[model samples]
Target chain A: MKIEAMPAEKAARAGGRPGSEALQRRLAVAFAGALVVVTTLSLTVFETARRALASSRLVAHAHEVLQVMNGVEGTLVTAQSAVRGFVITGDEVYLRDRDSALLSLESGVQRLRDLTADNDSQRRRWQALRDRLDERVALLDRLVVIRQTEGAGRAREFLRSVYPPPPPAKTGRIRAITGEMAREEELQLAGRMREEELASAFAVASGVVLAVLFALMFTLGYLAIRRRVAQTFGLNAALLSRTEEAEAANRELEGFSYSVSHDLRSPLRAIDGFSRMLTEDYGERLDDEGRRRLAVVREGSQRMGRLIDDLLEFSRLGKKPLACSAIDMTALAGEVYRELRTADPEGSPAFDLAPLPKGWGDAAMLRQVLANLLSNALKYVRKDRAPRIEVRGWAEDGRNVYCVKDDGIGFDMAHYDKLFGVFQRLHSAEFPGTGVGLAIVQRIVTRHGGKVWAESKPDEGSSFYFSLPQAAMSGFTDPPAARGGRR
Target chain B: MNRSRNVLLVEDNPYDVELTLRAFEQNNIMNELVVVRDGKEALDYLFGAGAYAGRDLGDAPEVVLLDLKLPKIDGLEVLRRMRADERTRRQPVVVLTSSSEEKDVVSSYNLGANSFVRKPVDFTQFTEAAKQLGLYWLVLNEPPPGG
Candidate 1:
């Protein structure tokens, strides 16, 4: 029983047990244990009560037998005296006394027989006593009859002829039999009383043991509940402090970013502006090498400026809460495509845009994702041929999956792991990029609870995929339903 | 161009001050430009007190190009004080600063700034921004009745 509850206790500790379930199990175990103890106590008390009842019956039986034996003895003595009186005085009143004594003795002997019937030894002794009483009564009757018929002289002569005088041993024989039955009943009563004492002691001991066990279980259960409550209190306090610490750290980080926004850019602006001035103002006096050095410095400063802007934008995503709603994928893609077309007017990429499914996300962030992915497809292309890009979307596995496939200068699959990393570039010089674009894209997609991946080969086309949860497409915020349009 | 109309350039950076002057010169706006190094000097010039105690307040600048980060009093506080006084309240103050944080922009507009523009790191963009500032505030847009 104890081993069975161990797993439940472990589950409670592991936080796998729900609050009510753990409490219910604990209460049930406690109740079951208490029930077992109470039932055992009840059974023990019941057995003690039965034993006490039997002991009481034995006591009553012994008392009744003793009383009946005394009555029989008294009646026998009285009858013997009556018979003797009648023989000596030849009186009719003495005969009446013997008759009344004989009647009482007969009833007493019958009661003794009934009482001693259950005990073999007692019944045998009773039978022997009954036989002796019958013999004595017969002698008494014969003497009385003799006295009434022949007169006092003849009755006395008959008695002397049967025995020279009354034999004392013979007359005391009935008294001895009654005395023996009474002594046996007294012995049985003493034995029954001792057993009653022992049984009473055992019942008291069981009551004490049950009380102690109840106290122990109650104390243990109380301590267990208190300990669980205290542990929960400690855990809550720790969680509160940890949340406060995290908030403080977030505030400090915001301050740092503010400084980065203000202080870091000022110097870079000065460097680029001063270097530009140097190039325009003193280019005539400086040699080719100096102009080139100045050009390199300007390029480095501009590149650093772009890197700082991208880094700040990336960090801003983390600080801002997402504004999620149903997104019109087709409209968003169309807008981004127009902007991309305006951005790169020289490279004419053949764009094939298929119907896109309605998705759920922040519209602005999703636009950024489309912008980055599409522009990436546009940017990484073989200079020899025109860029062929296809944008399509579908719903699968409870997600809206969008794919951007492009016939571009694809990358080696070995370095695919670093594709979404910040500041990681496959082709640094040939492709002019800060490499933070894909990282930002991944961050925005991930914030919307989506995943991004790519399939690319060295010379073949590359396809990039991102999926958003379809559950986010709510009926209330869906633009298509609101507009009542097929698009 | 209105050579007599004054344009105040309140900036702490010497390089930026020089760049702004070059941008204005290239744009061929020969307006009388008054350059102050910090907020205090700019306030003094506008209120005609402390250093410019004898100057006339009637010759207020046509436009004030204010930088936010400064040595003494910052630009937003200057704008707040300017808006408080009737003499400088309606003056065209455009916030030109290195910081483009949303808080700064919102606060600048709230404090009665006419416009807010972040200083571009690329000098060419800065030059174009300066040219537009000169043409729009000094030449195209109509000023308040008193200023």
Candidate 2:
């Protein structure tokens, strides 16, 4: 049983066992046991009924024996009365009645013998009664014949000779036989009563025992089910508490991130401010060497300011909620390129705008990603060559694939994993980036349930691809032209 | 060389005060520059109390260049008091500090400073800033009408 319960214990520990499941198992066992108990009880009741029936039959047989004995006694009394009447009146009618009583008396004696045949002592008493009845009938017959033939005087003389009113010495023996028959009838009644009492007591005791057993089983089943339910409730509560703790910790981390990003900017501003002031106030007082050193300090502070801004933005990305909306990639890309041109009028890069699929995402964030990628392509292109960038999109596998290809200084594919990591740069200081741009892009894409990857070689151009679900493309506009190039 | 037109420079760091004085010398703006190490001295000079009790209130500086971070009564409060008083309310006050915090800048501007300039860290940049400020405020910019 202990080994069998291991899986249930493991399930409970894992919070997989539902209260209802445990209760159902307990109820099933309880019901099965109840069914067995009911079957056993039915069998016991059937046996008890059979015993009771046997006892009832014995009681009924004893009652029939008593009735037969009473009939014999009545016949003997009628015979005695008829003989007296016939002797007194000397009528032939009394004689006929006495003969009919003698016939009934013989039948009663035979029935008494048949009924008492099972009891040896009762059978002997029945035989004695039969002999006495036969003697009485013969005397009555003799008395009747005398009353008919010798008339009333001779019949009286014959009755006195035959009966003599039961002599004193023979009266004891006759009373003893009658008392023995009465004792036998009483014994039969007592035996039948004892058997009935035994049967009834067994039935009552069995019923009480079965009821107590059933109650005990029911209590055990109920307690088992209750315990299992409590255990399941406890496990669920523990899981809920763990989940709450994890959520609280995540909230605290976010708050800490916001605080760090917000506070670190103050000191960085001071660094940048004082460095610029040094060059402005003492440029003439210092020599060329001092002036160049001041420029380096100013440049370092400016770079630090940019780094801090990028770091703050990266941290804020995790805390900020995304506002999703349908955006036209082609139009959005064109807008960003125009803005980039205005920002950097000296270096204009060529762009090939292909018919792009539109999708739902934060427009501002997506624009930032496109700006970063395009600007990087423009900045890192070979100095001898004019920068060429291509923006294209298409529908594939229930998702829209948007790719930004650039014929610029491409990276080795072996370092692809480092591209999306914060501050992980493949290039040297020549590439001016704080390295948080791709990290922010990856975060936004992941938040929208999309994926971003890049395919590139050392000399050849690189294409950055991102896929967005169809649901994200709900209200996007379709561009008329398939592709267009700009310089 | 106008000795009567004094400039009150309220700054905490001695190095920054030395640098400002050097920048002013390089600009050749010959005016008496009064230096107060903390907000208390600046307040003393304005109220004519403590070490400067017997000084004439009418001889107050033409401009007060206040630094926000000080040992006692910060620059904002000092500016507040200078503006509240009729005697010095019209004094041209400029906020000069190393801090470039938005809150500090906004608050200094809100407190009625004539101009706000962040103290440059590089020596050359600081020299350039001081010369430009000296030419603009002390030479070109006109003072308000007074007796």
Candidate 3:
């Protein structure tokens, strides 16, 4: 079978999906901008509302000034009429009425002056009205005194000169002055009402604009959120269906392998068996070259068998479930080295298993990993020197990395891309293998959520390092009894 | 002693059956060997049905060497049918096949197969395996009383 030459790192890189971080950042910026707009809108509305309140207050002040001015005019008219009646009829009751009106006249003018204090023009008008009222009250008082002390004839002459002299000339003087003040107050009231109306209208317009802006922003945000949700769900559903299809494909491949194991082996067995039978049953009839050729045929069939087994074993690793626990790396390496030494006695390298950091993974799988690396080191012993292998590890930065350094015939670093590829070999014949050991090692380490790589120069010793995450390693530990007996 | 009892070999491939027969002849057992090509033929031979009808109702094979892959019915179904019948439930059957996959071995044992063995590719190992089966079943293992 032609296995693809894709390296593990490149395959892992190809499987990654693009992230939604940019979309998330865009949403955050949009929300911040909307918040700023809403704050500015609220501030504008508050300023309009404050202006409207001040305008209304000014209008109320104008109304008070108008009322005080009316009261002053009424007090002046009452005092003048009472004083005139007293002089004309010589009645003491009219004199009492003139005194009481004159008493209230002073306070009414003072109140009008206080109400118009905020407006300079209205204050000046109030002063003019107060002067008029003071003069009228003084005249009325003189008339009252003449009526009481001297006689009715002199009071009558004084009143005729002041109040009853003409039909509208004397009353029109104070009334015209007060009418000017009241008209001014009324003009100011109209102006303030207009200002209040403009402020409120501005406030209402700004409120409506804010509401429309908010609604537009809300609908936009809601659509954006809904679209994002739809996109996310669509991505999830596609991912789910793709995962199911991949699973089904994996099962189909598994069945294919199962049938291939059964079907292919029988043909190879027949070839080998018949070859052996030919040599054994017809040995005397064949020449020496013929027998050797038949022997080569047997050797070829056996090698093909081994290759098939290795291929099947490589595929089987992908199907096996992982059983993870804390591993004593030192003991595992030592045991794997011991087995290698016993299995192949002639290639016993000087083994040095230094203190290794503990790990977390399936025991049998990791044992296979160690065995593959160590046996690979044993296989590539250079012709010039005695074999020397060293194994050691350390824990750093949430990971435990182990390295197996071998004084073997290392290959060139230029072919590093094919180092962990299935059935890829840099050098053949010198090293006898199907080149699946490193692939299996990489698979096991990758399954444990780890990484494996080799560093070497041609003719220098090679070093293979594999690392496991330490934080995940701390969660599982083998029992004290099982630690010693575990395979 | 049931010295002349029959040995039934259920295998579909012509080449494998020829090789197994050659191995048995080399072992010199000289017992009557009954070879069936498929699972249906094997079941028919055991129960005296179809082609083997009215021949020998009282005769039963001492051992059945069954191969998993067959033409008409697979070996697992044959084992299940054998274990279901009272006449063949206690029959000694050894599952012999080219590939002994884990699932095949598990299901074979689960269906009450007496023994399971992988057929070696090397002819020497194949001959040794045949010798061991012929000696153990025909000479050593005690057959049931009635048959």
Candidate 4:
């Protein structure tokens, strides 16, 4: 069953089995094969049965025609004998017999004519026999008249002129005609019997051939099934190994991230912790410049700590299984805005939250998106102008598109390419951030089968738009809870 | 109080040890806080084995402040071995580590840790946490008899 032309691994699992496409092809082949076998068997059985039926009908028709001809010939011979008897003895019984014989002959000839209506070959021979029967009947009537008027001697002379006595065994026209028709019917009967025999034999032969074909088809089907079973086993093994490999890689990634969380954070804690110790313990010994340097060291370490935390969060988002449900976007946005407002109590941003369309996504992830965007808006407030943030959403093209417009210090449009990139900051330390907020926004949006982008102009304003799919999308599977978790 | 309560701090980092000592001092936890640098030594001290052979198993520390990352057999293993043994089965373990990873907290709790606290980066906050931990485990909460 394995094809040598294919590679070893493929050869083991190929040839109309492993994949869905191959399975369909295999089913189609089986269907076509069965169709061909059944169609051929049906045609053979139908043709044989039709021929057998026609041959048997022919045999019955020939038998009926011969039987009718025998009655006609017997009536003619009996009528002549009855007429002779009447002429010889001047008997009334013989004349009555002749009259009855004439009636039977006439009806018999008419039935034969009707029966052979479609026979081009029998029409001429049967017509000659019909004319001869009419002549003999006319002669018989004359004899009867002679027996009534003239006498036995005159009737004898008339009969002798038409037909000789039985001693001579004369080939009379009526007898000759009937003899020829009988011979023709016998010939036809023999030919029809032969035809019936041949049709019966062919029927039996076709049945045997059909059985053999059935056996062959079954064998082929059995072999195909065996091959397919083997191929399935091979494919299952291949799939199992691939799955193990993927699981191993996933476990390794989990290990890497676990170490990143555990190992990377302790050192930063030390950096920030020691710097604070220096400022608190040796504040009097250090001058103003030295204290500022210590504060700088502490801020840098704290910033690094934030960077690590943000990156870890972003990494975890990829592996975190999503719990999706319909969310009240307006309420969620308002809640996030309230949370952000608590951070900046002195300057309250004019938070215009419109009635948003209901969104479908993981509530926690979407909440994160909202928190990041709103916090960014609140963080980048232009001190010269009052902070004004607008939250609005609308349904579009099987998605719910939400926009967070902030009239704050927007960056130049040229650097928008790096706006949602991780650690790709457009501004320097003047604007304090790890440049992971927009990246997180993009990640969450994309995970929900959506898109995120920004429209901005420097010194004017910026609007961040993100779309969440209205329904489940293909190719976006909720990942299973990560395995290989270690403490 | 001249002596508060006996506490065991399982830690590997020297810097973390110094800071923890400073925290205990600032909080005025006037007790002998025994420190074990690794998981093996912590197990040894708890079960009175290896280097802590012939050590008294009855006057056990009130709380074991454990760190997850260590050189010999990590902190989760230490908690597991402690919980599995009859002598130290009911010992109160508080996981105080810099790693705020979810697995560490969950696994520590699953391994029968009393509490899981992520050590804050700021020394002031660390000091406050140490004080609260001491107050709760040593003074406010009652320890098991003969533990």
Sorted by DockQ (best first), the order is: 1, 3, 4, 2
lDDT of 1 at A440: 92
Cα-lDDT of candidate 3: 0.82
What CAPRI grade goes to candidate 1? medium
- Write candidate 3's Cα lDDT for A1-487 as tens digits: 2122324533453344333576567667667767866897889888987887787787778777777777777877788788778877888898788778877878877777778787898788777777767776677778778988988988777667655657247668778887888788788778778877887787788777877877677677777778778866876676667667767878888888888778887887888889988998997799999999999998778777767777888888888898877778898888888888888899546888898878877889999999999998899889888899999899888899999999888989999999999988988866778888899999989888899999998788899999998878665555442253155
DockQ of 1: 0.51
TM values, all candidates: 0.65, 0.46, 0.63, 0.68
How does model 1 score by TM-score?
A: 0.65
TM-score of chain A of each: 0.56, 0.52, 0.64, 0.63
Q: What DockQ values do the models have?
A: 0.51, 0.05, 0.46, 0.40
**How many backbone clashes does every candidate have?**
0, 28, 0, 0
- Candidate 4: misplaced stretches above 4 Å? A1-30, A42-193, A204-249, A473-487, B1-4
Q: Write the per-residue lDDT of candidate 2 for residues A317-423, one digit (tens) a residue.
A: 66567777667778878888788888888765788998777767777777777787777667767676777899989999888888889888789999999999988
A best-first ranking of the candidates according to their lDDT comes to 1, 3, 4, 2
Candidate 2 local lDDT, B1-147, one digit each (tens): 232678999987776777788778877978878999999999998889999998787776777888887888889999988888887788899898865555678898887888998765545566789888888878897887561
Residue runs of model 3 more than 4 Å from their true location after superposition:
A1-226, A382-386, A456-460, A477-487, B1-5, B25-32, B55-59, B128-147
Proportion of native contacts kept per candidate:
0.69, 0.03, 0.51, 0.51
Pairs with backbone N, CA or C atoms under 3 Å apart (clashes), candidate 3: none
